[model samples]
Target chain A: MVELKVDQDKCLGCGNCVVACPVNGSISPETAGGHGPKTEDVIMMVENGVIKLFNEDKCTRCGTCPLFCPTDAIFLE
Target chain B: MVTNTKEVKGKDICVQRISPEEKRELAYKDDVCIGCGICAKICPTEAIELGEIGAIERTGVDESKISIDEAKCVLCGMCSSACPVDALDLKLDEKSIKDMAEYPQLIKSAEISDDLCIYCKACETACPRDAITIARILPERSKLVTGEIEIDKDTCISCGICEEMCPADAIEMEHHEPTSSDPTVSSDITVNKDKCVYCLICRKSCPVDAIKAVCRSCSYGDYDLNPEDSETTGSSFIDEEACVNCGWCQEICPVDAATVEKAFEGELTIDQDTCEACGACVEICPCNVLSFPEAEFGEQSDKVQADETYCIYCGACENVCPVEAIDVKRTAVKHTPTKSKSWEKQLSELKT
Candidate 1:
């Protein structure tokens, strides 16, 4: 298991991580098609202006979200 | 059976379509893609679409700006070739057609030669897109200059004059209040060695001659260090994804290290009859080609001047002018040729 943390200051909310996450892709095709998730049952989604984590159980600890982050806002431990 | 798959690796997103006869792949980069919508506009199959760019940029939210429809896409590579930032890639049978001679390739490019570059950082300042970044390491200041400072405790009356007068804030005085029985005050002064630039301001300001200081670099004719030991060295890099081929770097570079090929060939003209000389176009021009001539004899200039040599022909001036006085005619767009009628139609739209 890994911990996911998004630095609010650094994050630009570009949604690069939302498209990159395998769990998000599995949950809905809208995310895989390069759009934000329409369903709520996902690991993370863009809310208000920044990304917010929802279903932590869906995360496979893939650690791909941090790699795609342009501003280094996401950290997995 | 046909299968479609997707994968994200770092900044790159790759989508693959496989069948019995052929295998095709398309890749997009998050960092390189500026969400300019050029690919979406040029897509022959209408497979690419753009999201709300203005809302996403203003809010700084996690929202995708570009999306592709796999079913509608034919993997023709039109969108990949039309992208200004080179953010898209299409491959066939494990080989990129862009590398092949049969396909037309965009001749536009930007390059910087390391051997010829002196690291002057002129290009970094001139780039309108902020695409160039230079990192330089200069000689250490302490090695070049040597200094010493001292303060006498007995002579220092704790008047706090030197501490107040210090420009570098290097001096500090700690004061102890006198007891009722004993009416004498006691204090200690300290000079931070690292913070002190040895300007001798505190020493000169001392009323009781309490401070002594010396700077050796001012008097010494020559130091023992070699000239080569203090040489400046560093690297400079241009962000290919961010560069717009504006030719500003090439124009400002003194060493001829930077080279650029522009994306458009065009002419811009201002109608004298309609122009009010509000200087709207001058403020909007990103390439700094347009400017209002200086007023003479305390009279405001009635017209704006333009230097066409640096103009990238981006049509920003035409869009910004409120009076409809400016006309920008794009004679040609620098892109790979295409046989598709839709691509030709899209290319025609850019010329006007």
Candidate 2:
């Protein structure tokens, strides 16, 4: 299974993953690096056009988050 | 020496004339720098850290900026694109395309807030450098060691897992702080046991000061002329109550006048203070020449962890061999030399 490890340092929290994710609930935002495996953060991060969030469990292992990612983050394992 | 200041000093804000030699190095920051051709476009000398856009230096900087690895960058921009005169020259390496592949890793500086880390160890499980140490924070008399974050920087890949999962915001991704742009050991870290009393001179001399003062009841050949324990016994005492017939001290004695054995049994003996406590002789002598007697292995200094295996044993190092610390036999059997899956490296890659 392709697991996903988000790069919070670079994650702009742009919500790209939130929108790209096939599952309704995968990925969220936390200013801090991580969050519970489920649930999203209240804010969003967008960096150099790349986006990321603190929500971990929302990911479906689709790899889509990293695929469309401009920054090449989101390792889908 | 540079303190965090809102005031941009030196080359940070001012446009300084750069030398051709300095223009050679640059590390790119994708976001902070807009890559407005102005940096490349305005170079008075046409010097900038250029990125690979199109065949022509087009409208927008394709991606990547031009900063040399932290230590190498002279920060001189005779060719800054920001210059209106267009004198700066932004040069890149032929292998830059490959460098771009290593980008994310260049940017991440692991950051942490003290409150967020729960020692969940999720990140620990993920870290490849074994750089992240989960030391327990001990309050005076708390009798408990709460987790403290220690990094063996040499091995760290700059991954942000600890920063990512830290519920308490304790871990952070910091900018790569180059210990030495031209890394050189401040001094040699070898132990000279003969002329040396166990006074720990080199340990005090280290700038990074990667040394520890370890005290444990090491085994001494019962026959040692100057047994470190002799001081406690007021010269020496043969504990008839506990003396075992296995007189190891006599066989391995370099000076055989005071043999600890009835004959040359060749068991081997040890000297606690002179031992360097490297555990080397114990691992190699085929007989255990030393032991760290339940020695609460002093809270290992971060440098020790940092130095763990960096020694190449190549003798190339003017300093100690990173390999000297490793026991070939123990490792072959244990195979547990602080494993990590490049968590920091991956974080750095994504950051780029």
Candidate 3:
């Protein structure tokens, strides 16, 4: 099983990963529209300017979240 | 013989006047111009004409906000020197007079350090004029790792254990009634293909052996890659002509990467006695310095608050206020020392 790891120091809380995840778009249309998801049911979200992993079960393991990260903070290991 | 030429090249509008003794060129950047019409007003020959600024701004049409008459323009550089945003650039014989120290320059500058920048894009979001731009590049995901997962629905008991144990939120449990009040409590579980990261957490946590997951990279040969190849990298650029030196980028940058020297120093005040508290200034403020206090009872008060930390003193808020309660007093303007009498007069007019 691959592990999802986030380095807090490298994270700028940019929300790039959250918006890039397709699962987040399915959970909330706002994410697809390029804004943060308003609901709490998504795979990940930016909380207090930092990203927080919520429902990991909903992730398709598409590797999209880490692909769009500008800081390389989020990654699958 | 004398010759004149005009060329509009990708937002860089240029008008040239050539003579045997000297060559003069005036360049205007359509993207950098704020449509303030200051050039039109200051043009000595009245060659500059402003377009429908209000309509252009409303419709967001891709059109230049100002037009210049090539034949009438004398290329004196008056409008260029007078322009606040440096949208107009006048060059004499390949070099500008400002560069040669014959003309004064604005004492304003902006710097963004690539070393300190984290590419959070806060500056881009906070910039009042959309002057800051950010671009980011990341590694390809497929090249990094691969995995697969499958659920045996027939053998699955639908106990909701996998749903609870899943780290990716990829599982869901649904109940199916058997028509009668059957004690079996028939139920099933469905896996969301989009969310399943094949983490195997649900597979290990399940009481029954129903989930099968595999990490190809782990079992097979790991992808040969360097750590730096997986690194994210990008840069941010600020348009010199579009940036007003407002310090929004400096103030919003989380890493202290952006720095700006403001053009004008001033005090903005709203007279409470005359102010209707219509929040017009708050809506019109470009720097986001003015905002109404949060109402507790779902009803707003007649007071507005101002955060003066990043204010550039542009006078936009004052102009938009209908009650005439807002006052913007410019005490100083940042400009290089000048010898021109008319420029000094204009500079004096700014210092109220």
Candidate 4:
């Protein structure tokens, strides 16, 4: 079955996707994930920079908000 | 099953897939399209050659392949989104130079989305050549995609700074969980891809990764610093007419790019990418130093702190200022290991 992939370099943090997601954490803003034991995570925006430890378990896979990007920066694929 | 994207051989891809539902539902097969009007309009590139794709369009198979023109290309980068089949690519027209990098036996390139991202910009960025340019500009939300602190792979001495200040748990120093004995098999930065919005604050705070970061491709124009003039520089121009010198620019600038250059001159200048809001200069100045004129605070962002007194002009504060808060020509500061790190990395690095 096909699944959604969030391109980290393409996201703009508009919060448009967060607002559009129907499921909680279905579609979150992040990158790279590994098996539970491996602990793969994404770099996030900390105060004025990047935080590189976001959890994948937080994702809901919902494809609502990525559809609203005017720049096509956010996608559900 | 046919893939949602169809590849264009030599042409430029500029058609974005606006419908997330349509992308998720796209079916695919080998030689199925007959250049029929069916998938043509569906194709963002209009790249289908009639007889080229006849397998599935004729009815025998469930999918077909569409032939694409390799020459008439502009690379605005959108066709991958247009394909209802898994043929087109949404990646940049040209691949990364590393697309051809030779991995020594001791240095086998890690398999990134190995199933997909053969172009390893991240590894390049993480490792050496200052080689990483974040190759693929996937159209999802490119604007918010940049890292917060500047990780100048060139100067990144690997001394993770800006890592200490993260209160939101955003940055991290990824210890690549090696898939094998080769520590090089990058676990690097496993971005919770869906969780990050590319705020770029991370890029700025890294203390290590610093880039001028002005997206020249950004047509928004440059930093028309001389707002009094009519020229546009792609940055937020200070509209002298409307700019009441409220210090909004100073505060709004996450990098402290904007500064109250000469409050007496009634003009503030944006330093761009070097300013971190420690509020030292703002607090030291007796002239109600750089601040939002309206002084409005609505949970939008943390209010800047100001304590004019005790703010000795010894320039000591500015010297330690990570964001370069003070005009050195005007004051002084001492050397301190003011560091910032990816909060997420700090936490995870601290985690088991």
Q: Which candidate is the best by lDDT?
A: 3
Second chain TM-score, each model:
0.64, 0.15, 0.62, 0.15
lDDT of each: 0.72, 0.30, 0.72, 0.31
Give the residue spans of candidate 1 off by over 4 A: A1-77, B1-73, B91-103, B112-122, B172-195, B221-232, B254-257, B263-265, B272-310, B314-352
Interface Cα RMSD in Å, per prediction:
20.6, 21.9, 20.7, 20.4
Show where candidate 3 strays beyond 4 Å: A1-77, B1-20, B23-31, B35-75, B93-100, B138-199, B204-207, B210-232, B272-285, B291-293, B298-305, B320-323, B339-342
- Residues B112-180, model 1: lDDT tens digits: 888888788999998877999988887764455568899999888888898899877888887678788
**Total backbone collisions for each predicted model:** 3, 89, 16, 128
Highest DockQ, which number?
4
B1-352 per-residue lDDT for model 4 (tens digits): 3223434323222232324333321222322211223233323345544321111221122223334443333232223222212233333224311122221000111112323333323333322112123344333332333333334445544444533434434445554545656544233332243334444445566665543233332343335223334221221223222222223333433344444322111122324234333233343232243443344556443224433321222222233232333442322111112132332222122111
In model 3, the Cα lDDT at residue B300 comes to 55
The single-chain TM-score for chain B of candidate 4 is 0.15
- Judged by DockQ cut-offs, the docking class of candidate 3 is incorrect
Highest TM-score, which number? Answer: 1
Residues B1-352 of candidate 2 have per-residue lDDT tens digits of 3211121232232222234433233333333332223344323333344432221112122234333233323443322222211222233432221133322111112322224443334333323223234444322221111111233445344444433433334334544434756343222222322222333333343345334432122333233333332321112223321222222322322334222222111111222222222222222121122234542466532221212121111111101111133222111111112123442222222110
State the local distance difference test value for candidate 4.
0.31
Model 3 misses residue B259 by how many Å?
A: 0.9
